[model samples]
Target chain A: MSRIEVGQRILQEDLEWAKANSLLFHKHRVGCVNMISSPGAGKTTILTETINALSHDMRIGVIEGDVETDLDASRIRRTGVPAVQINTKGGCHLSAAQVNGALGQLPLERLDLIFIENVGNLVCPSIFDLGEHAKAVVLSTPEGDDKSAKYPAIFARSAAMLINKADLLACGALDFDVEKAIGQARRLNANLEVFVISAKTGQGLDQWCQWLRRLVSQVKILGQA
Target chain B: MHEAAIAEALLKTILDVAGGQRGRPLAARISCGQFAAVNPEALCFAFDALAKGTRCEGMRLQVEIRPVEARCSACGRIWTIDDGYSRCPNCSSQQFSLLPEPPLLLESVDFEDKTDE
Candidate 1:
């Protein structure tokens, strides 16, 4: 018999279920950002800094995914921002279904940004699309420039790239060629936007903040009645 | 690592497509491009794990890994290699080469309906 090819239709019922909760979050004019990176690349630290800087201007919420710990959610709660944690119970990456479930618990209507901090891994998160407008991939300087070469998919799929730990450049053992990393990333995704900053020293954060502001503004404009 | 989640996605797709089919689907053909970074055996095992209690039970999954080879406009040579190689096989020219990313796609399912006779 002749073969028929079909497009990838993610299980509809499951997807619909995922959005059932998240759609309400968007109804409040919230924009979600899925931050993915390898473990110890400093995702939590970066997010903490972001919240600290923008909390006053923007109402932020967080959805933290980890193998087994409420530690991250606790950290976010310390800042007094509404945050929910989803312990995958050992899953490597967070699924859209899991995020959808977590969103129901969040106060989405009052939020300007919803950040989903994914389980720490470079591979699996690249494959699953969590229905976010943009995927931000974080790469630390000490993680090495070769990281992009080894894990191309993560960098390729990300709409924005954040090079964190810039302050460690002098003392750190790793020699990162930021330009080369950016070039390699562009080779894969020509439209990829690059941002180099240290979540610790706060170097180069203004540009990133500007980028976020622009994205939020665009979403607002698009959602206008 | 996320094989289980991926397996779930694959099974769901199979069940949805097989719903309108004639007899129970006996086999499914999947085309996985080299760039997809998916292991066929792992995928098969995952399929088995997730399909046990689903409509995809007892169905055979046949995965075909498509080669990532392209003709180099610079050297005019076509070569087959793994997903990692991006430079031209003959001239090592990145400019005039075409690289194919591995894409995962469900090709078709096989079944027969006796009631049509």
Candidate 2:
């Protein structure tokens, strides 16, 4: 009745660390978003766009994770927001403990939204919860429509899907069908909200921004009540 | 790639749970839920490498695989699935609350203390 275990104890320990970080996030009233996707999927671009759009209206902070560079965090800081970069050295994903350490350097009390840009790997980040309210998977148009079926684990655990680089869809280089891709994603997470946005062209980003606004407002209302 | 980090995390948890036992531990048993996409071979390799020169060295690592299962909260239907299927089978409802099928649990540990007996 028992099967061979694969990373059970390790994952459990990570889960405990994740829970501890979650408690800190809740206490600070920070709505954390763990942004995950394949490398070159424009995770940082989306983050920059998000920060630019909301920085005027709300206080925002970012935790940029990468294998060995402060490049992403440096870019985020250019947007005039407090951003911290976590160099995993060789880690494929960002754990809650790492986030916990980086959080100490940032002003969590001043931020309404905290975006944790996970190391660019769909497979690894999905396994470790970074104490986020929800995790988002960003797939560029060129990644193809089949991503949902191919990497269901990330798609399944994602609370929402951001179809980036919509402008590239016209070039026929990307076999992406926004509607069908959304349909398949819904099969895994029925409540998943799909957004087609071009962080470069500024297309379909308003909807995403609006959704974020709603989430922030809801958090505010809940806190007040 | 993160398997090494995971292994390190596991060792810390084991030591904490063991409560500073007076002797070396023999082995540890763990259960991984089906939803957790962990390659057993990679994990074993990582664990072996991480355990080197540590107190947990030469200990047998046992991993148990737990398949993903879902029971609908509204319809009360239970179904076992491969990987990404999260909906209910009978009522086709998405309202089911997930049971913690994936244990990711450190079930038990074996410690050796020839001197303490």
Candidate 3:
């Protein structure tokens, strides 16, 4: 009997494919962001708002991921941007392979930004790299402030955290401590950028839209560089 | 939940590496970081379920969960943190980065040659 030593990463193959996918985006000068959150974190709302807000200046495309329905994709399409729906049919998160397939369907040359709205899952989605240039997590105020502490993995990996449902702060229904949430998230990831916004009331949408525009421009510059 | 995906990847890697080998894989040793948030038992169970009727059937999964190591940016003190806390235990500073890099990795694979026996 002989023992063979195979020291390698298990997901190296998937990661390589993801890297290739990223290269494809870079070639097209497309800035992609993977947005992840829990089921009711208002990802669709924020994404639709961002698309509407940036539609005039930037061409946007979306790959909506969900377990069963294409409703989110429909919502995105209503905003006059190209939208593709990926129904996992029970899978928890969207894989890079799936996104690679979706990339073929998108009008890559026409899009300045592509937002791959990951399946509404904080844990599994964070684990899978979808070849996005940036990873963002949306946390609704109703979901409570302790989520960053409980789900540190996603918070740590995310480049940006969008605190949605900020208008609900006046309702007094939730004891959402914004400071604690940002503190815990910063502890896990010191470089994490936090944005407090409400998708429903559009309270802080302008800042979020401006940040996204800057990211798109930066990506374009980097591609040229 | 995501353990299923992780297990499938693990088995696929073992099979690909053990290509042309005349025996089923006996075991695989994987290294996971505390920051990875992988449940060892769930991963094993998923592996067992997915390995059924495959070449990797009955393979033992040896998961080595690596504790998160944090380095204090202020004092330069390094310590292993198993609790997923980012703060340095020595200086109580929140500014630190996890050490021993690569969050999750498959360190090695162990297989027995049944044809020789």
Best by DockQ: 3
Q: Write the residue-wise lDDT of candidate 2 on B1-117 in tens digits.
A: 766766777887776755657667778887776666677777778888877887887768877777766667779897775655456779888665445556567777777654634
Residue runs of model 2 more than 4 Å from their true location after superposition: A1-17, B16-24, B72-75, B83-101, B111-117
- DockQ for each of the predicted structures, in order? 0.31, 0.31, 0.60
Q: Which tens-of-lDDT digit does each residue in B2-69 have in candidate 1? A: 66766777788877887776577667887765555577788888888778877677778888778765
Best by TM-score: 3
* DockQ category of candidate 2: acceptable
Q: Give TM-scores for every candidate, taking all chains together and pairing residue i with residue i.
A: 0.82, 0.87, 0.94
Interface RMSD of 2: 6.8
- By DockQ, the better pick of 1 and 3 is 3
Compose the digit string of candidate 1's lDDT tens values, residues A1-225: 434466564344445654664465456777778899999888998888899888777988999999998999999889889899999997988888888878879877678888989999998887766767688999988788877678877776788999999888778577888898887776555568899999999998888888888878777776675
Candidate 3 local lDDT, A1-225, one digit each (tens): 567766688778678879988999999999999999999999999998888778798999999999988799999998899999999988999989999999999999999999999998888998888889889999999999988878877887888999999999998999999998998888777789899999888888898888888999999999999
Highest lDDT: give the candidate number.
3
Clashes within 3 Å, all models in order: 2, 5, 0
Cα shift from native, residue A73, model 3 (Å): 0.5
Candidate 2 chain A worst ten-residue window by lDDT: A1-10
Candidate 1 achieves a global lDDT of: 0.77
State in Å the error of residue B84, model 2: 2.9
